[model samples]
Target: MASEPESDAFHEAVPLAELEAEGRALVAVEGVPVALFHHEGEIRAVNNRCPHMGFPLTEGSVDEGVLTCHWHHARFELSCGDTFDPWADDVDTYPTEVREGVVHVNPTPRRSDPPAVHWRERLDDGLEQNLRLVLAKSAVALQDVGVDPAETVETGVLFGTRYREGGWSSGLTILVALANRLDDLDDEDRKRALYQGLTEVTSDCADQPPKFDQEEFAARDVPFERLESWFRENVEVRDADGAERTLRTAVAAGATPEQLTGMLVAAATDHRYLDTGHTFDYVNKATEALDLIGWDHEAAADVLASLVRGLASADRAEERSSWRQPVDLAAMCDETFDRLDDLVAEGEGKEWKRPDGFTDRLHAADPEEVFDALEGAIEDGATVEQLARAVAYAAGRRVALFATNNEFSDWNTVHHTFTFANAVHRAAQRTETTELYRGVFDAAVNVYLDRFLNTPPAPEPSPDPDADPDEELEGLLTCFETQGRVNRAGAHAAHYLDGGGDPERLKAELGSALVREDTGFHTFQAYEAACRQFDLREDAAERRDLLVAAARYLSAHYPTRREREGTFSIAARLLDGERVHGADAGSDAEVATGDD
Candidate 1:
């Protein structure tokens, strides 16, 4: 019986004789139920409830100085009440004393620090150890206490740059981008972004040595025009070092991110979306990240440097003859904007209009018709806001239906296009960037034009309003995980939601199914885009529409062929032939005799 003091707070829990008779006794002291155990002539007291699932510890079995919860079999040391399993946190133990052959417990248990404080300490530990789950838990807990996500991001950014010798990477780029978009997000999203950034930075820096700082570019006085040209020329020539030097030189000369934004955007768009839209998207995201980080000139330089890598390896779709000839796409795009300017001026006093069937036309996947419908809506007093929504919806359709091979890394294709459209939509919420919306719309038209590549076209979605969503969800998960039914998964989700299924539950399940395994970059982008789309859940019909589109896009390029043609068949024949020949003495002779 270990006791601190026989203060007035101590209350008689049970008679020592009764505890010994039953081996354990549950007693209420100051409204707190405590379980007193009599083992080896010693009295020990702990909380009556198991911390893991609230199972009564009084029913737990004590053996070899350990108390085991029968509910989940979680074990704890009775003496100190330390949980053997990490999932079950340590139980609270009360100081007990056998005074006058009676068990007395200090009903008032020792108070632990606040949850936020505890989680913050855990966050520090997680960062130190680069532990993923701990970092994730800490981020969620910190956000629950209304802590700013920027703080967590700063921690990760500092840790990553300090530890990772490779300078900047895609993870860092994305983390920076997420940080830039953090303030605009809801609490859950902010926390998730923080967790993602922390995890990425930690993972990227883990086991890597610190990088030596680069020698400062001495040509700080170089003209901005010349530096800009040098950066583009270096990126064009795949001179990564030269490109980085140019960016660093420009930054060293006191170039603000706004001042340098034009150069990066120019380099990106100068070559018609350097990598099937991904280059432009990356530039945009990196710019957004720079804006969010707020005045870290070194990080700006690092971001631009990493972007040059993408610029170098990116397959420029602009260079392709398919994009250039017959259409004069630039002229058409300019003409649409010119008309848009005229319409905006004409509809100054008129209320913003939404023509019926506008969404249907977009979902029909006819680019020319979509443009026609859009132009009509503009003529009918549609505002820039309306156009933005229309274009965003169109973009979601592309995300739902875009498909391509792994060789070309079509995932990025889908992601870049979706993100580009999404960015345009977000921009629309604040300003009237009509030209940007047109650009997004024009790029989306190209996505529609490339639909033939989606061999074994996506199956049409049947809107079963009276179906069992839970049953559909089961199949959706199975197909998504095992059979690569990406599009079908979206369709199933739509069906599940239409059948009165819980949106959050389905979203969670969809998220789990999509990311249950190790996924590629495109998968992550697509899912993130999906989450953004789902978050705008005003209408269930629109949600179903978006999901159906996603399913179609995902399913279009199924029965994927990552290997060369006949590779598996040739290997199988060789393996089978060798095994048969080894087992049968004259298998080749029998084949030859049969042929004769």
Candidate 2:
């Protein structure tokens, strides 16, 4: 409700009541559009055009004693027309006052003042001096944090201040300085502050008119050799724990991969701290470098996969805690897949060249083929849960294809496999199905079950017992296998045996496999199958033997499953001679027998 400023010139005044009736009213005064507002029982006037984007504030609304621009919704307090949000510049307030029943407005002409050149020069000089002082202090700080400060001071001072003053020739020099001294700041707050200040200076220059050559800022030489030497002199690689700690510290300090690569490579070549006899630490360093430098999607993905491979030979406990857990790798792979999918979906006819050599063979293949390979790898040695995610990816891709083509009926075998499983799961609670859907579901499940039962043996354990179990597991699981061929074999088995093609031969072979003593649970499952399929009575002797084996196996190895009451039987049988009888024994009797 505050009035505008007072001035010497006299002008016709409108009544406060009248102005209130005409809220957000506009009028031309001295060839300028002035907007009038009445709030809190007071009159005010301001320039009609918004300071930002020049929208007409007069056409806006007066809400809660504030004038809001309708175009972009920038709001200003009507009392003083001050921009409540600093992001928008404040509105120009005009002089207005009430005299008796009328409002008076100042009509004095406002003079334009050019920016003071002397002031600008003073600001520039002070800013440059301040930057130079900061750079000198920062150089000393860098040295204290184990970083080389030999050439960084001059470069940082010159480039950082010059860039702030619209001098492009020195911006690139600042970037180089930043990259070189990145590993020097041990304190996160100090490091972040330095980067923030540098970024602010650069951004200010970038926002200004192009007064300097942009190319100069892009051409500054990065001192990779100096950085490498510094790392070699400072970073110690005595063990994996030390390596991880050092690498994490470097990442926190903002070290770039390009700058840290030579040092990492040297460490690996020297076999320093080669825990698990692999280069996982070096791989992790490379990955950290890439992340710090904001590498492109493909480059990041390549580095991630390389890290995974390096850690692939670690123990299960190590693998879970290592940088290459399935969750981590799956996330990276998913991101890569999404990027690839987006590129394809754009239909720009741009083909991304796949990575070179055997490591990238799967990248160039079709999505389904890639998924099949992933599944095969999981079946052989990879975690089932991880492989299930890949299957999900394939399923998602199939759906996307169907959406694009509208040809759901023309799916390939692989597509049908995923689709049918998903559809059957969704339809399990329902009763209706078309012949095609039913057939596909039945065929897919039969094929999967047959393949599952006939899965090949897992990889052989390493001869060295002291070898890290996680690494062994990773090696076994990540080794590429042909899932498509396995699936085909499964389908063939299902067709000839479960599908009534050669029941007699199937029974003979299965029976022989079932009787093999080393077959373990497979034999018990086969017997259960026979009982269910052929209506055979349970063989007491066979059941007894199976129970005994199961109990022994559970007692010796199933630590994860030991909490189950069923598992207690194994221990009970070994400790107590009394056999458990029928199911309805009294609790007291059961407890007495259990104690015995």
Cα lDDT listed for each candidate = 0.61, 0.35
lDDT of 1 by residue, 501-552 (tens): 8866665554443322333345445555555665765766667766665444
Top model number, TM-score: 1
lDDT of 2 by residue, 390-485 (tens): 332223222122211222222232233333232222222121212112222122222332222112321211123243433432332222122222
Clashing pairs in 1: 400-549, 400-550, 401-553, 487-551
Model 2 residue 233 CA deviation (Å) reads 5.2
For each predicted model, how many residue pairs clash, with residues at least 3 apart or on different chains? 4, 9
Those runs of model 2 whose alpha carbons end farther than 4 Å from true positions after fitting are 1-6, 13-17, 99-102, 107-228, 232-596
Clashes of 2: 9
